[model samples]
Target: MSNNVLFDVPGPRARRTSRIASIVTSVVIVGGLFYLYLALEAPRVTANGTETPGMFDPTRWDVITDGRMWNAILVRGLLLGTLKMAAVAAVFALLIGVIFSFARTARSKWIRIPAAVLLDFFRGMPVLLLMLFILLIIGPGAYWAGVAGLAIYNGAVIGEALRSGIQSLPKGQRESGLAIGLTPVQTRLIVEFPQAFRQMLPIIIAQLVVLLKDTSLAYIIAYPELLNIGLRQLPTTYGNRYFFTFFFIVLIVYLTVNLLLSWVARIVARRTASGRKTRRTGPTAGKDEKVGVDTAAMNAVMPDSS
Candidate 1:
């Protein structure tokens, strides 16, 4: 009945319904996970006289009488390769982002538009197709094709991400730096980028989430990332265990990485906010000012005061 629309509240029955829905959702999610676990260990039947169970067995982990396929495929093959590729990608993307972000935000028309066009050309291109093209041109190898592909596309996107963050900073910050007689580049490097980077931490993390998932595409070019490894270990009887392998390895990694990043971002944001509070409380509160007022000189100064 209140005039303010914000006063609207849910009734008791609605709260009960919400709780009921939450319980149902939780049950479904748990059940799905359990079912997938069962499917992963669902007995791999082979052709002719040989039978290889295509699943990870926890209880009999030591009894790997055959090949350590899980170790080969999932560990040394996919997991390590992914981490390596992602690390390389992050560094390259960071470099690209810095260059593009600076160029885009620069006052020079000649630099900004052209740089923008180049970034757009790369970013707009399909990630998978672009990687494949590079693979064909550059020849196949983990570092050459796999990591290179990750770097090219991710870096292009990261460049734009950085530029967006820089743009979102308060306009007054840049203007103030300029008004204080700082040069354009000085203003950006010293004032704009630091604050902007802090504020854009959240979005940068979100982009990382995208980067994490895109690693799966490496499988297409035989890059032997986690998914690629998982596929190789697929049971003949369980041909479409992609749902399990991918969900367990890929999505698990994605969620875990994103969550960890989010936690780090939250900590950084809290620290940044605390820093702002301290700055606002009084930047010069601690130091004693050196007032060089000699007593003898003060007597002479008092005579001149009249």
Candidate 2:
């Protein structure tokens, strides 16, 4: 007897059909993967005329055993190149997002309308095209071009998210702040904005993870980020036969970073929920003391009337 209005609860026969569908889907997926594995493992003729499955070849994967290879791919490419760019871009994006959010939410139509238009423009533009446009103006500095492009586009998206979070808040939040002698700007900055940011924090972090992955787009602009270094330079240095090995490593690193970010978001959401609960229950803690003091003060002021 669920009250959910979205759909009817499954009956016994429906449940059986759902379970059968699930099993069939799982088996099809497993079968497809196994077929893919066998296809990759099949023997093929190399450019040098030797027949072997590249996926199973030891020579292709031997580069992983080299310390220099790891140093080049992991240390230089991942840490210095990709992570550095992502860190700088993340900071800039956050700042721009806050500014854009405030502008978009401003009471003045002059500020809000233009801000909305600009945000829409950036949001609609492709990240790669933005990077290329920036590259043309910046001239020969792919890193800055990529950073600027990522910041601008993601800033607009984050701004919209924050705006949505702010709008979703009860109207009383704004009214209360204004009733307490705060100006509109003060009410937004000191009260509304912080709550909105906290409410939208998990979404913001998830957007940042998307930004991190988008750093790979810098490759098209000739920035020496992780993908360029691992997919291009490392393969050339280690021989093209090891290309898939480098690609596999890069794939794993991306997955690991994105997963860690998602985990952090979950932890933040949990903590935020717990903090709100604490605040909800906290006022009762000092209720008796407050009542006792009020009673004593009232008695003192009443004098001989008692």
Which candidate number would show the highest lDDT if scored against the true structure? 2
- What candidate 2 gets wrong by more than 4 Å, as runs, is 1-29, 46-49, 273-306
User: Model 1 over residues 50-100: C-alpha lDDT tens digits?
Assistant: 655546644333323335655754576556867667777777767777788
Clashes of each: 0, 0
TM-score versus the correct structure, for each prediction = 0.65, 0.81
* lDDT minimum window of 10 residues, candidate 2: 297-306
In the range 125-242, model 2's lDDT, one tens digit per residue, is: 8899999999997664999999999999888888877777676666777999999999998999998898888877766787888889899999999999889999999988878878
Q: What CA root-mean-square deviation does each model show from the true structure? A: 14.7, 12.6
lDDT of each: 0.65, 0.81
